[model samples]
Target: MAQEPDPERLRALEARLAEAKGSKAKPAAAGKDFSQAEVAWRMVLELTSGIMIGGSIGYGLDYLFGTRPILLIVFLLFGFAAGIRTVMGTARDMQERQLRAQAIETQAEHSAGTEG
Candidate 1:
């Protein structure tokens, strides 16, 4: 036969656990840093993919048309331009997001300051 558990000990354990949980600081900025890294990678990939796709298209057209290097060069330039454009757009979007976040943070701080 098993003995009954002590209620007093269980209550003490629960209290200790609660205190431990409450004492740990949350890593609030860790997630934001990871997301920023992801965005940067996304921008790099978008630029690289754009250039690759354009180059491939140009190569294929050149081969079919028998225009040799002429078409390939032109297409390569186009691809580079497209990639740059895409990168610029992504940068703009990132800037906008940063500005918005700053504005929100500023507003929150203002509200908090006013409250106290």
Candidate 2:
């Protein structure tokens, strides 16, 4: 048979659980600190995937038409172009988001200052 639980320990556990629940309401201050390496990897993958997809399509077309090199080269170039375009877009988007975030933070500070 199992021993009875200790009442004092059970109350302590309950209090700890309550404290944890209360702490969950506060927003994390460091949550915005995303890793630069992670963003770099994401950009690299996007560029490579675009290139790979273009190459694959070109290869398929070349095989179908029995024009081995021409279609493949054309498609590879197109894919590289597409990847460049995507990377440019990603950079622009990241810049816009960063600007927006800064604007919001600035506005919040302004409001807080006025209210105080």
Candidate 3:
């Protein structure tokens, strides 16, 4: 069982939401905000999960087919591929973020030069 929503509270919430939507708030985070520390953390998670999933799949395949090492080897390779994919994607995202910041800085400098 759930509690019923209050009409007044709902209206107040709606009004607050409308005001928030109308306000111009700066984005708190962008792709560029991912630091080396953050990337490293994410990489760890990615590699761990990739290895776990790959190992599980390989182990399962091996068990099912009565193959000794083929599945494990193949799955480890798959996990490596996944890690590379994550690294590439993260690098690309960081590059894009850097470009965005550079573009913004360039625009600011141009405007300042023109004005002064």
Best by TM-score: 2
| Model 1 lDDT tens row, 1-116 | 99999999987887787788885343356345337788889888988888888889889998999988888888888888888899899889778778877997799789889999
C-alpha TM-score for every candidate: 0.67, 0.69, 0.67
| Candidate 2 residue lDDT tens string, 1-116 | 99999999987887787798874233446356456787788789989998999999999999999999899999999999999899999889778878978997899889889999
lDDT of 3: 0.82
Colliding pairs, model 2: none
lDDT of each: 0.82, 0.85, 0.82
Root-mean-square deviation (CA) per prediction: 8.1, 7.4, 7.0
- Off-target runs (Cα >4 Å) in candidate 1 are 1-34
Off by over 4 Å in 3: 1-32
Q: Write the per-residue lDDT of candidate 3 for residues 69-96, one digit (tens) a residue.
A: 8998899889878977887787787788
What is the clash count for each candidate, in the order shown? 0, 0, 0
TM accuracy, model 1:
0.67
Residue pairs clashing in model 1 are none
